[model samples]
Target: MVTIAKANAELWVFPLSGPTGGSGITAVDVIVVDIEDSDGRAGTGFSYVLGGGGATVAAAARDMLERFVAGQETVPPQALWRRLAGSLNRLGRGYGYLAIAAIDVATWDLHAKRLDMPLYSALGGVARTLPVYGSGGFGPTQDPDAAVARSLEYAGMGCTAVKLRVAGAPADLDRIRAVADALPDGVDIMADANEKCDLARAQWLVNALADVNALWLEEPLPAHDTNGFATLAANSPVPIATGEHHQGVVELVPLMQARAVSVVQPDLAMMGGITESLRVAHVAEHYNLVVSPHFLPALFIHVAGAAPSIRWMEDFPLLEPLFDNPVGMDADGNISPPDTPGHGIQWAHGARQEYRIAE
Candidate 1:
């Protein structure tokens, strides 16, 4: 029987070229959790903080390992996930969930490794190939020509779809026009506002993008604005998608039931690991809403294998910089599940030495 022998957490910060979306992409904070069992097996998981608070997340992760996981006998992953959530009921989905995400993911990785099975197959292996979309085109930094070039770059790579960030201004219509006009034939375009718009602004965008033939508009209103999203959905020429920032399935259910969103996007870290992510996907399937998880296609590829409702896997490459063997897409714009056991993430040589904060 494998029991948790040791667990620790550390912080890794990486600087970006420029601002990404509205988050001001100066640097990213990563909380890394390393777990080991009595038998000497190991697992690693991490969460991303767009701007700051890496210390808090890392501390919380360490606390979780010491308080609940260390010395515990390995058990069914779903049971461990529940125990972890119950242990931190008071935190109410704050930084603690981020910690829970990393630990729970590590537990699953350990479990999959113990069984010598690829995580995708362990998750149920519903599909071998998941379609992908190139994600970029930040506004205020990437001008129309630059955005167009980026879109074409993805298109040239055989990507069927590409998503660009909307500036959420009256002039955004012009930017969309310029990019839309330059897109190659048969390539689909999508827009993301990153919750930068109010109801009126979202409506204006919906109306302005009437002729762009965008596949969808993401987070036009804030994630919590279900009423506004419902209102927009009633009038939108394009489908609406949201939920990356939602705390859990509770926040997402209303949006799906109200027909407020056509696509449901959940970040694994924000959604609290594979257990909850699969739960969300099953719920979306019940409601007939498309599930497209936000970021980390490499990890979410396993979820796609298990959840048939996951329509597309996004190729954001947010964490690729840190991995020596990052997942890649095929010439046909599709990605296959990793054949290796566990999540198949190979950290770059000396990554922890280079990025880990010295204690």
Candidate 2:
């Protein structure tokens, strides 16, 4: 019997835009990997493309695929992750999450494939599909009416909750009130100031939202404003959420240690990948916190399903048409994880005409 063989990688981009913090996702660039053996079967993995900027750390992935991990015999998933992870550490930059993210996820893709089982089942089977909330609304809404209308639309779609943006605009309080007034009872409201609010103003916004029963106040202060985060978290009437900007585990652990956030909201694609998110989850769990991934909800859902403390997945449904068969959403607003081999991502080849190479 032949042992194992080689691996190959891809730099990809899908044409669509997702908006956040005044920016829209004009593309989805990722580094994908395919690993094969002496007998010829293979498994695939991927990472954000140059931080989803059109290059999936391609040069680095090429280095790893060529220098290591390509022709090795199949090993335990954790061991392979460590080996790929270790390479980045030895380089001393630790800016290799693209390398780390691509390999680690692909390794799991391979493991799930080898067993012909969905990733969640391979890990431990699903605990629950978990509740999901509508993530983005009032994003740079030029018209306050349009913004409030959009927020209500999300709630009307049966989302258990909704997140509205406050651009640090002068009438931010009015916008919050407009949105809260639109949402019905039992449908919770959360607000993101995108760090537009300083500690003092964040406190003011939190207090203003309290009358509306806000579920949480997200990133009211700039991300690095730890004292601001602590000040608000310690005293804000609304729960505080953050972590979409943290670079890696080292940074996140300390934040969790300080009780800096009520909810650990890591973006899977941005937080390096499932590997680092799991690390964040452990820290969040140790501190008795909830892990709610920030975006790219389709992939994040699987990771969320695996964490015992995952409170809810982010399922901003507006982006559904961007994918081939968008994730399943229901009348009650529950989001379900697909029982597929990989993350259930399949690009429609020769179907969509807008496809472009992000790199």
TM-score of each: 0.96, 0.87
Give the C-alpha miss distance for residue 198 in model 2, angstroms.
2.7
lDDT per residue (tens digit) for residues 1-359 in model 1: 77989888888987777676555677888888888899998888888787788788888888888888889887767898888888777768878878888887887788788878888777777446888998954563467788888888999888998888885786677678887888888888888888988888888887777788888999998889889999999989989999889977888999999999999999877887888888999999999989999988888888888888998988876778898887789998988877788888878998888888875
lDDT of each: 0.83, 0.68
Task: Find the candidate with the highest lDDT and give its number.
Answer: 1
Q: Could you tell me the TM-score of candidate 2? A: 0.87
What is the per-residue lDDT of model 2 for residues 149-255, given as tens digits with 9 covering 90 to 100? 77677777788787777765667767777777777887888877776777777777888888888888888888877777877788878888888777666777766
Lowest-scoring 10 consecutive residues by lDDT in candidate 2?
A: 350-359
lDDT of 1: 0.83
Model 2, runs deviating above 4 Å: 1-6, 15-21, 37-42, 49-53, 90-95, 317-322, 351-359
Q: Report the Cα lDDT for candidate 2.
A: 0.68
Q: How far is candidate 1 from the true structure (C-alpha RMSD, Å)?
A: 1.4
